[model samples]
Target chain A: MSAFNAQRITAMQWLSRQLLNQDVAGRYFDPLIEPLNPRWALGRMIATVERIEDETHDTRTFVLRPPRRWRGFLAGQHVTLALDINGVRHHRTFSLACAPETWQREGLIRITIKRTPEGLVTPWMHKNLYRGGALEISEAFGNFLLPDVEAPLLYIAGGSGITPILSHLESLACREYTAPITLIYCIRSAQDQIGAQQLEQLQHKLPLLNCQIIRADQGEGQPPRLLQASDIDSIKNIQARHCYLCGPTGLMAVATTLLETRDVPEEQVFQTFFAPLTNPLTDTAGGAVTLMRSNRELTVDSGQSLLEAAESAGLSPRFGCRMGICHQCSCRKTTGTVVNRNTGHVSGPGEETIQLCVSVPQGPVSLDL
Target chain B: MKTLNETQLQRLETGLDAIREDVVSDLGERDARYIRRIIRLQRSLEVAGRILIPLSLTPVGFVAGTASLSLAKIIENMEIGHNVMHGQYDWMNDPALYSQDYEWDTACDSNSWRRTHNYEHHTYTNIIGKDRDYGYGLLRLSNDTPWRWRNLFQFADYVGLSVLFQWGVGLHELEYEKLLSGEISLRDKGGFLKEFFRKGGRQFFKDYVFFPLLTFPVAGKVLLGNLSANLARNLWASTIIFCGHFTEQAATFHEADCENESKGQWYYRQLTGSSNFTGGRWLHLLSGHLSYQIEHHLFPDIPAHRYPEMAPRVQALCKDLGIPYNTGSFGRQYATVVKRILRFSLPERLTRQAA
Candidate 1:
């Protein structure tokens, strides 16, 4: 409150408490004047799943409406979404598989998620995520975008790598782009190709779009259905096009090698992986250690975060916003040094509050959990 | 640039890093308890003060009610609001104290404050043309700011700003200057205006219209009490903030001078750009631990309660490095701030001695 009219403010608050009820008034009024929803005060952007659509046997597209606090994102950007299941919050990055235009017009963005057999979050999302479910989303970020130049484009997508490419195609189709574009999507079989309907719709809308699906298991005729350098060489004007490859690591490597052999410049070929990037700290020398927290004692891998090690040991800890920003995973570091994965800043060897998600154990570190 | 040798820069970096690591390691349950307790105390005082307002027909009731209300507002704005919004105590993971979600009780929208204060002000510190808090584009705080004829009325503007600080803050990000220069149209500011009106309306109705009408026949007494308490809070807030920032010893910088600023140079800038004042524990709390502004600037995200403990160590480091640690008594620092304000009220060209 400013010096101007301070008294009336006090009386008004008093009256509000006496009349409308304090919590009720605050709930109804504060959000009107504030950006965050007071009810879900998790210090992160919250989005509600408005609808869900299964794209394939293993892939589903979730349409989410984020709160007004969200600043929105560009086409082909990925967002880190977190969901708490059984009190343990898990976070993963998913590409926005819908056009940015849709978000502006209808206030919705979609992410097509393919469940990895070993993944914790995706499998749960496939089973438990329903319409009207609320999940925490980070602001969208990533630089894998179409170049401004009107060059002919060749996109090679293997398995779930087609998500971001789908977003680019949808956005471009909406913008009435004139550049010739070709997508060769490889899956185990035709049944596993996600967003087939959407791709067909986009192809029908754009005159310059050419999409083809390659099913490895359906190669019953002349040749094997693996992407080869000769296969890319056969495409008209393949040498003049910019190549974008995304998918499993093996496919990416093969495509990159093929593209490079054809004299494609490094900058002309772009790639993005949805899998977790290998932690650089894992290469650092750290002694194997025991983590003692609450009633659990478990052996932890050197150079791995206490949170990850704890999860590996089957411990469920309360957490929110897995990034260090939220600090929901902060626990007492009572006895040893740890390196912050985000900043590479080392902690002092003493009792201190350390964010569990980002702090990699330097040695045998003891956490209060 | 202050021309420090490589050895000196390295030494400063090491010292500052050690201090940060030590303090961060020291954070524990006690710090969490301190902030949580402060929130509870502030809410309790506010509730008590508001409840006491209707009894203002009696002299003692008026005194107690206004005083309690002012105390609550002070704690909320300074300790609870400012500190929480700084990302301090964010490690607690308590939803109520989460920096991004916390909305302050002021005229300024919390999002705007985060942009202007948390991101820009803290990142740039006292760098000229960058740090908006350096006179807030109204006054000429440094000689680097070209003397404009309009600055002659800055003293009046500053006074008006203090009286309605929250309003000034709310309007800070609107860029009225650009709007006046015809760079942007009303249509461009439509969204901003809508937000401003929404937030400003709530503040106005609560303070001026709603409560006064609630008191009925004795509405005048309640209105007067609320007015006095607000004025008291504004005056104190202005005084403490000015003392920490504008005292004679606080240095200002050119943006060019801060280019490629090393971690050591960053620490040096924070030390030179902020002034501190001595006070008791209560005064420290009331000031939102801003009394140790040097410490606050050095470690903006650390809990303010730790500033007192970190101050002596930082001061010692400054002494060893031969850097001037600017600090003084509350009276002396505040007097120096007022002197600067008055001195810079007129254009420097006009204020120059006869040559």
Candidate 2:
């Protein structure tokens, strides 16, 4: 097992398995029956709205409107955002805030997008999209939403994990539900938080609802004590509640441990990983370019990475998290070498040049795409 | 009486009446005591077909092996469960004298399947007014061609995947229905309806897709053998039941007149409606008493176990009386049923010549 793969398995566990699927159908007809379905191209983009809330520096939450006919999804469920940067199309999955039924009823869909240091699709969307713009979104998909069990909910969210958790609260609150509900949302510094006003409105609206917004940016308030198990104990019984948490990489792991140590049923606590993979090309002053995706070789330009060279040669490869973290772009190097910009180390020394998101092929390479 | 042109078959009504009387007279014999023995032999052929099949174990890395094994299990179970439940072994006892198929709730009592199925489907065979197996949704499940539908302009039964599910909806309801005529206590009604829907959904899916998908072979592996076997169970299960009522030669009358249809007329209907599949006595036992559906439908009270001997006696009686008695090997009889379907589904001029 690769260190990149998560140890915990699930009912539909195949979704999280990092697979490098190239658009390989154009070459030969597939005669054998396989469960692996291919990625379809983004056809005409339906007209949509992008309501933005400006935070500091370039980060913000872009509330995207899904096509009206496209309804029915749980919060934390993300759509793969289709982008055409420099005429190159790619997809990225983002979690939607609020329950599917809410957007279904209100004629709106909301996505809380944060601008990374160099987000390819995010920067493009923040600049171009306005009300009634073409918002190219994929079909709503994901199984990470809160399960419809009878357990009381124990919500532990960090960063954007709060989106699905908030959707869960909104759904349960509407039924005037009899089940127990608790929410813990963690954010970096108070200003980066967007949904505090919505949470405040929900607190005053529902009688049995409890909301806690914890800040991790300890300046004057000690970041509200980092949402421990004891904090949830003060609110309601934890034994009979379903816990759903989503957020930063470190907080997600710690929350998973806290709940397990607290003896919450493993099935009851759910986590949605926000760590996505996308590639941002940087100049490598081409010594020699090796594209190791099949024996399919390509030249790496001083300006473009191995992916760009392949795309320029009319080979459109699939990628989700262009960052090396998501492993979506990892290809095998039958032979050759590549340099990783993040670690500044050459991986193809004794091995082959794998598509390490931000890596460029150093020499002649063969890839098993 | 009109005689079929192609064969030695004669519509000898008087001869049929005499043969019917002769069958009852011969009933004093050990094998013929119960009127249903002839049909039991047919079911026995189907019963014997279910041999001890070896299980195939699959490797863990792939899901291929597990699916095929499950399919084998489905084939075996569907045949055994259906035949055993149907009381194809006619000697089995029924506690009451009743026929029921009103989607009812009787959680209070549980011993009603024997009466509803063992008595009704066996006695009435494919009579829509009585046989629980008969379904009337857009797609009809059973084989018997309804006189009313035949007289009508449009098709009541559709074919293919989409229509198969809708027609099968009623068959699935059979698993939960209380089908009894006792006092409807509130508790019984409540318990029955609640459990019915909860469990009913599974049966609906199982029949519609799970069963079919399970038997579907994975790639590279040829499945026509297993396919043949699975289909054998299915075709055997429904066809035997259908043969007793759907054959072009089968007779029907208004339910009001079922009681008045002369004993010979009833026998004639059973003879024409049902068929005999000759050869392989061992095949008869394993497959349950399906091949002898004609004899079983004629006498529902007879135990199916005795049909092997009774079938030969019935055939002889028909021969002696100079009346046409339908008897064909399994393959031929299967072809006949298929022909009857074509006769029903196709245009009149292209299919069976109307009487």
Candidate 3:
């Protein structure tokens, strides 16, 4: 009882400090500690797999019962699920699915995972989880949040990239903040959509959200139907607005290419690519040039980064700072000529020049790679 | 031209000529197409006051300045000299030049920068073999090269003096030219006598004595304007320059390592070669886009003012390219410099470098 009373006092004092805007995290944590250290916070799994939906062969959704005393996260925060597999520790990040209000009233949370080929964590998650299974979780982290910008928002997601968007939707639902939202969640097929029921629930509950799940594999849509470069044609008036992208690296690459083709300033392009980048410099904003010494090729692309196409074709090259400052990424043209978009610097000398680290591939450009 | 020593002047001209040639060749002759425009822009800003004085003649001055004390006569002595090089008069119909000074309300665009700043300095940054910013000794801003023996004393000299200049602006200037002459030049004797005192004198009285003492603060707003402007420029411009190449984190590449030199290599050298300071709006706006040193290095002509707008794209690109784009506020950048100094000074053999 005495310990309980002291705990109550400490909680109240902590609440007071929060209201007073004191540095709480710094007051407790070792400031010099390396960021990569395991961050373990005690969180209980209250509810488990209410139901499962097989969106594809490898993806599923599991509604969870969080601890009654557990605090909910703001929309868009990610929680790390820790699982002890054969006494070895493993953790995987999952986006929260429950609305903050649901945490208050229902004391529940939801998370979805999709199995990627050869990925250890997701494949295991798909096969083993059971109803009401306890899950250890880490504190919520990540900066994917809605800004105060009152402008109507457009969200683009590819594959499993919908996780954070789902969290954002739940948060908006909890806050009762009315803002128009358009989500173009691209999937391989109609059956590939993972959170259809939850999305339908959001669409029904909040009339302000618009969700469009593009099915590329079905081949039933109009031109640029597969979420290609022309998908951003409708956002011409969105000058100075924000763009949030989350998806497989290739999808992000395509989306970025589409945005750049529309002449959207590089500043407005918000992208996050979560897959392996076969060619890291695909859709560059600009830096270091790639040069082709002998092959018959052309290099100039306002659409996709020049370096990306080359690397995509399995060319090994050396480059850096695709943003444009570092010359380490420079290449030389033993024969052809190229132009730089950033400083308007061009150096195609058919003899020895370089490809900018960031310039997207335009035509059939040759490279020394 | 007569005022400068024959041989010394020739060397300076030769140095600049070679740099210009590299700029044209390295950048793919794009400057060839835009050379006329850049030159015109440079000339106009150089004679700004001469023409402006005819229109508004009053002791109605006091605008804050952007020049730095460590930079020597940057405001007092070298203002007009740089103006002559930059061409501020081009602002008549040009919004680009006007926006260059937009961050600091008291500041105005002057010409010296188009050639001296925007073109040469930015494209070249501070590679000792190529960049003018690379002075001898510890005057190094980049770490791509290893420290030479001579730099041992120079480093001590710079740290001591640079720290002092960071405190007292005026006192630092009077002594800076002599101090810099030792390492940055093959022949250090000329700039102090001919270039600094005489050349610096002509521009000083016109900018400081005539502009500040005679014409400024007269309208009260002008005085407030000049002081604020000067303060803004000093804090913004100097801090930006410092963050980009001066911080201890910037590279000091060796003459040998710069092999297989190409434009992209140069770009990477400059991009990874500089440091970014973590600071406030005063630091961000006044210092140009230096807070985004990594971004600016990746895209020099994008304008320092536009860097904030480019941060996301830069971040995304850095991610896509798998390169580390270093940045932080002033405090963070400073802390980085402290760490850099420690690492740079450590005995080399004790360190196990990566293969």
TM-score of chain A of each: 0.70, 0.64, 0.58
Tens-digit lDDT track for model 1 on A232-270? 876787777888888987899899998888887888898
Better of 1 and 2 by lDDT: 1
> In candidate 3, what are the lDDT values of residues A1-369, reduced to their tens digit?
999998987875554333211223332122122122222211123234556656666687777665444556876666766554432234556777566666667666677778876866677677777764555565566666676656566789988888777777777776675667778899877777878888998898779887777887756554445785445665546554456788887678777777676666776666543333244433434323344332324334353455554555433244333444334346644343444544345554456656545444333344554
Which has the greatest TM-score?
Answer: 1
Fnat for each model: 0.00, 0.00, 0.00
Q: Give the range where candidate 2 chain A is weakest over 10 consecutive residues by summed lDDT.
A: A14-23
- Two-way TM-score contest, 1 vs 2, winner: 1
Off by over 4 Å in 1: A1-318, A321-369, B349-355
Summarize candidate 2's per-residue lDDT along A206-254 as a digit string, tens digits. Answer: 6666677777678874534476667655755576678777877678778
lDDT value, candidate 1, whole model: 0.78
Model 2 whole-model lDDT (C-alpha atoms)? 0.50
Q: Candidate 3 regions off by >4 Å?
A: A1-56, A68-71, A219-225, A261-269, A273-369, B1-355
